[model samples]
Target: MNKRNFLVTGASLAAVALLSTACSTTGGASGDPAAQRAAIDSAVESSLARLFQENSNAKELVASAKGVLVFPNFVSAGFIVGGASGTGALRKGGKSTAHFRMTEASVGLLAGAQSQGVFILFMTQEALNSFEASRGWTAGVDGSITFVNVGAGVNVSTQTAQQPIIGFALTNGGLMGNLSLNGSKISPLTFN
Candidate 1:
């Protein structure tokens, strides 16, 4: 196929994949407030455990964070017009205080699907309150978010961890580099 044809075909396929996945995943249990909350809770627990295992210092970060938003299973699939969506919980004092959903759309040179976990730690009470107060929060636009890269034997010091907001993207499957939250928007999910 020609270059133009190839690009068009790829974009079409990606859109189809994204729509199908969203429809299937966002239906039934996802529509159920209780079920969705349970899923998000489970995801947050598992993601936190993994983070703690990778870097013990994360435990301290979590403990100190005023609130943490954990999206355990964020799935992103795209060709050129890519989009991602996931549900997560906001935890304070080790308890889920609210639920939220993160969504983003992008148009660029990209393809394939990826499943990953994302954790955003609000290090300050002000930051946490701002996020909660916002009707819709867009990362990188609404507020500056620093991405934390944790490697072997690496530690996040108290000073370094003092950022107002810190984000971690954990790749679980598929392409890792293809996922990002630059334009992602997070909003509260009402369960009723």
Candidate 2:
């Protein structure tokens, strides 16, 4: 086989493997529902604490927001073709109102795997209501989510805080860089 063809084939196989793994483990639907909820809750709490510690601006944004949707462990892996999936809980008034799962697929020159925590804040009641009422909410299609780059020593701008919907991606080291929520689908999860 030609070198280019061989490289393409290998990358395709790797992408498929990564996608299947993401589907199987995201949200842990195969396991007990209560346990899954508990795990997600714990992760969410820890992630929030970390966010607040890293960026003081986050606490204010979260406090004023109508609801917070947190995905503590969002995994993305790709070698050319790539996909990402994660489960999260929607919190209203500091309580878990419901659980949701998010998934996205892309085709581009991308390679690597990353696990990070993602937070989406609904700054307006209308935005939060529309999300909750939808059967399935897509990031760009349902509503635009403005992803903020809240890295160390960087403060969120007042304009970003005023947006109807805002998002942040956090890693163990600190905030992640260049997050995109476009074309991602979020669906309500009902545990059996």
- Each model's lDDT comes to 0.77, 0.87
Tell me how far the alpha carbon of residue 160 in candidate 2 is from the true structure, in angstroms, after superposition: 1.3
Candidate number achieving the greatest TM-score relative to the actual structure: 2
lDDT of 1 by residue, 1-192 (tens): 899989787787767677567624532466777786777687789888887776676788889899999887777778877777888889999989998888877778877877688888999889988999899999988777777766545766566688999877777531122334777899888775
Candidate 2 residue 59 Cα shift, in angstroms, is: 1.0
Over 4 Å off, model 2: 1-6, 26-30
TM-score of candidate 2 versus the correct structure, residues matched by position: 0.90
Model 1 stretches with alpha carbons more than 4 Å out: 1-10, 16-20, 23-31, 157-159, 173-180
Clashing pairs in 1: none
lDDT of 2 by residue, 1-192 (tens): 999989977997898787677756635544788887887787889889999888888888999999999998888888888888888899999999898888888888889988889999999999999999999999999999898977767888899988999998997778874898899999987666
TM-score of each: 0.85, 0.90
